[model samples]
Target: MDVPALNQTSASLTLFCLPYAGGSAAVYRDWQTRLPGWVRLKALHIPGRGVRYEMPPMHGWPELLDLLVEDVQSSVSQPFAIFGHSMGALVGIELAHAIRSRYGHAPIWFGASACKAPGSRERKLDWLSCPEEEFFDQMRVLNGMPEELLQNREFMELVLPILRADFHLCGSYELRDREPLECPMLVLGGSQDLEIARSSESLSAWARETRAPLERRELDAGHFFINTHRDTVISLVADSLARAFHSRGSGVLPSRSYA
Candidate 1:
């Protein structure tokens, strides 16, 4: 795992970000510029991607979560928050749970974006079981990457394994049991992403995992809306960060939404 430090501010709240399936920390390269000066963004680059490309992806939850927990444990420097998209959202839950259990500090807030609430998935998708052609077909349906990259054999060869590993983690994951988190939860779903969870109502299932109120909002796009509707997504998160910090009577605001 690789986490590059960005937005080093003294009075800051660190926001540890995780990327969607098949995505690297590169996806959040511009976030540091958009977030306010009081927030430090540490976008984790999971192994086998970004600067860690030589490494292999972990296909199971236990190993992946262990790495995630370790990465956060070593990198976090202050009161922190977590924001993840798609597969990252699921990973964030386990990461936060682990952080609280082992380190005894829950993030001030949890932001889950473009993912269904755990256990609410409509159906299991074993992408690993699919033949190569069929698996790429699903990729076409997801449309996360550019069509040209899908056509580029060199790029596809490098990325397909990572995607497969990530999908295996997502499809096979089960939330058997865990205690609710102490901090608040914010859930963001794409308005058109019914293939995963039916709708925002389905996203609301996240309420079961947090002691604080769950805030669910649906953006006007599909599963990959984080790109198509990037500005809106970022602004919503900024506003939420402001609200969460202010609610705690923290003297500093973390996002420009308050300004």
Candidate 2:
């Protein structure tokens, strides 16, 4: 259909991206032009934000994962990789597992940015109930959202529900699959992020999730490092895609153990 966030092309592989909480499909729409022409871009637009703003927000993973899996199953008929940032990282991991379980194949590569390994993170969703002022401050420090917008009452009012639902989506999540994914994985964190991924050690914990090769990287920015460090993220994705795709293949799914 008329999906603006998805760029369907005659590329060798598709990279499906999930955004951090409060982020939508628009987050990766700009990456299409920067990425090598061989990889297609399909940033799944979650309902109730950005392009699908009219749909009600999803409050938890069961529904969200259903949507994610269904969307990917429909669009990704060929080999593909998955990447997610922050809250998106958590969702992406689950999405990968769900896709693998139901479809019997895993992504060729998976990348998770600015998120701690699942089940190892400190419980921080308490901020979900904090006062608006406190929530604003926390989100400001965590995601680097514009201070003016965070401080603006009207703006916050309009976006707060969506943000809260997004937070719930990540906060209420419990990783179901304990076995490491068979697909190669890349885990990334921000060196300066004091909130979620505070240190390289935290990011490194992701190694336990994948039986295949896993790489970890820390950038020199804050939580939303991807925004400022787009080139590096894009480059990394391209490199991984190349390494995994091996130059001339289509319609292949990486062999992986599921469930």
RMSD of each: 5.3, 6.9
* C-alpha TM-score for every candidate: 0.88, 0.86
lDDT for every model? Answer: 0.79, 0.76
Q: Residue 51 in candidate 2 has what lDDT?
A: 77
Best-performing candidate as measured by lDDT: 1
Query: What lDDT tens digits, residue by residue, belong to model 2 across residues 102-213?
Result: 8877788889998888867655465457678877777867966878887788888878888888877666666564567877888887778987545446677788888878
What C-alpha lDDT does candidate 2 achieve relative to the native structure?
Answer: 0.76
Which regions of candidate 1 are displaced past 4 Å? 1-11, 75-77, 122-125, 146-148, 197-201, 252-259
Evaluated at residue 91, the lDDT of candidate 1 is 89
Native-to-model Cα distance after best TM-score fit, residue 83 in candidate 1, in Å? 0.4
Best candidate, TM-score? 1
Clashing pairs in 1: none
Report the CA-based lDDT of candidate 1 relative to the real structure: 0.79
